[model samples]
Every structure is written in C-alpha cells, then in structure tokens.
Target: MNWVLLIIAGIFEVAFAACLGKAKETTGNEMISWYVGFLICLAISMYLLVKVTQELPIGTAYAVWTGIGAVGTVLVGIFVFKEPASFWRLFFLLTLITSIIGLKFVSN
Candidate 1:
C-alpha cells in the first residue's frame, strides 16, 4: 500500500515536471494554468510522499520516487516534448529502472 502510494506520488512528480515543460512553451493565461497544475501536482506528490515515508525507509522511498520522476520526465520529454532519445539516454534510463527495481527488492 505504501509502495503504491509512493508510485502515485512519483507519478505526480512526473506530472508536475510535465506542467513545467508545458509552461515553458506557453504564455499568459496558458502559462498560468500550467503553473497552477504544477502546484497542485506538487502538493499531492509531497503529501503522498510524506504519508508513505512513515512506513517505508526514507532512503529507499526517496530514491524510488526521484527515479520514477526522472524516468517518467525523460520519457515525457521524448514523446510529448519531442526531445532527443539518443542511445545513451535510453541506456541510462534502463539502468535507472533496474536500480529502482533492485531497491524495491532489497527493501521491506
């Protein structure tokens, strides 16, 4: 359950990052809307993270959260924002994913 909430929190982290990216590409009202979305997602993400940290190890939870955020944001950059998906980028992403999984397995 805690792990599930942690994953959701990480997803919100990704959402906030996506909102920031969108905000960068817009102006005026659109930019403000994206910023608002960012704030909302940020709040939810932090809330979930704090909740889960009560049960899960802080180091593991934080690494997994940030790992999910990093992986998700990079994928969003590639697919949604049309950023480069170079070989090295994908290679490192795979490594990050592996490390996250490894942490989950080693943790309670």
Candidate 2:
C-alpha cells in the first residue's frame, strides 16, 4: 500500500540522516562508507517519497516524512552522539509528531 511505502520511506530518511551525522564524526577516510550508505539510503527514500506523493497529497507526505526524520535524527543524536536530550527539545519533538499525525488524519 502507498501508506506503507510512505512510512518505510520515512524510516529510511531517518536512517540516511543519521548516517550522514555519523560520517561527519568519523575521523578517518573510513567515513566514506557512511557517505556511500547515506547516498544509497537517500536514493531509496526519495524514490519511495515520490511514489507516495503520486498517490497522496504533497503536504501530507512531506509532513510525515519530515516529522519522522526530525524525530529519528534527534533520537540518534541523543543516543549515538551522547548529545543532551533536554526537556524543551523533547517537548517540541512531541509537538511535531502530534502535528504530523493530525495532518495525516485530516488529509485522509
């Protein structure tokens, strides 16, 4: 289903973004692997996004994709990078998730 594709794309979007962050953190040329991984994931994510957009509303698809990416990136930044997960940041993340869900529901 298109909805399943949309969700999968969102997950891949988050994965590629997290890989990009990791690539930046790598000190040596080994980071190239992350770059490659990022690109591959990015391509797949975009493909799925375009497919979903063909059948769904742009606003809805984009919001869900971006929201999932944002939340997933913040979570990776906190857990993988040992970044602080402040209360305010989590609050806004929750807000973003809520808005994304609301948009999806309304659009459908």
Candidate 3:
C-alpha cells in the first residue's frame, strides 16, 4: 500500500511537471490555471511522499519517486510536448525504468 501511494505520488510529480511545461506555453487565464494545477498536484505529491516515508525506507522511496518522475516526465516530453526521442534518450530511459523495477524488487 505504501508502494502504491509512492507510485501515485510520483505520478502527481509528473503531472506537476507537465503543468509547468504547459504553463510556459500559454498566457493569461490559461497560464494561471496551469499554475494552480501545478500547485495542487505538488501538494498532493508531497503529502503522499511524506505519508509513505513513514513506512518505506527514505533512501529507497526517494530514489523510486524521483525515478518515476524522471521517467514519466521524459515520456511526457516526448509524447505530449513533442520533444526529441533520440536513441540515447530512449536508451537511458529504459535503463532508468529497469533500475526502478530493480529497486522495487530488492527493497522490503
């Protein structure tokens, strides 16, 4: 359950990052709306992270959280923002995903 919360928190981290990206591309009310969304997602992510850290090892949880955020944000960049999906970028992404899964397996 803690792991589930951790994953959700990481997903919110991705959402907040996406909101920031969208905010950068807009102006006026839409920009404000995106910023608001960023704040909300940020709060939820932080709350869940704090909640899960009580049960999970801090080092492992933090690494997995950032790992999920990094992997998810990169995919969002490639798909939603149409950023470069170069060979090396994808190669490293695969490795990051592998590491995240490995952490989950090795952790208690």
- Candidate no. 2 TM-score: 0.94
> Sort by TM-score, best first: what order?
1, 3, 2
Tens-place lDDT digits, model 3, residues 81-105:
9999999999999999999999999
- Per-candidate TM-scores read 0.99, 0.94, 0.99
lDDT string for model 2 (1-108, tens) is 888898899999989998898899895677999999999999999999999999999988988998888888899889998999999999998999899888878886
Each candidate's lDDT (Cα)? 0.99, 0.90, 0.98
User: Deviation in angstroms for 78 in model 1?
Assistant: 0.2
Candidate 3's C-alpha runs over 4 A off are: none
Q: Candidate 2: lDDT of 48?
A: 98
- Model 2: weakest 10-residue lDDT segment is 21-30
Error of 1 at 73 (Å): 0.2
Give the top-scoring candidate (lDDT).
1
Error of 3 at 40 (Å): 0.2
- Where is model 1 more than 4 Å wrong at Cα? none
The ten-residue window of minimal lDDT in model 1 covers 50-59
Q: Which stretches of candidate 2 lie over 4 Å from their true place?
A: none
Tell me the tens digit of each residue's lDDT in model 1 across 1-108: 999999999999999999999999999999999999999999999999999999999999999999999999999999999999999999999999999999999999
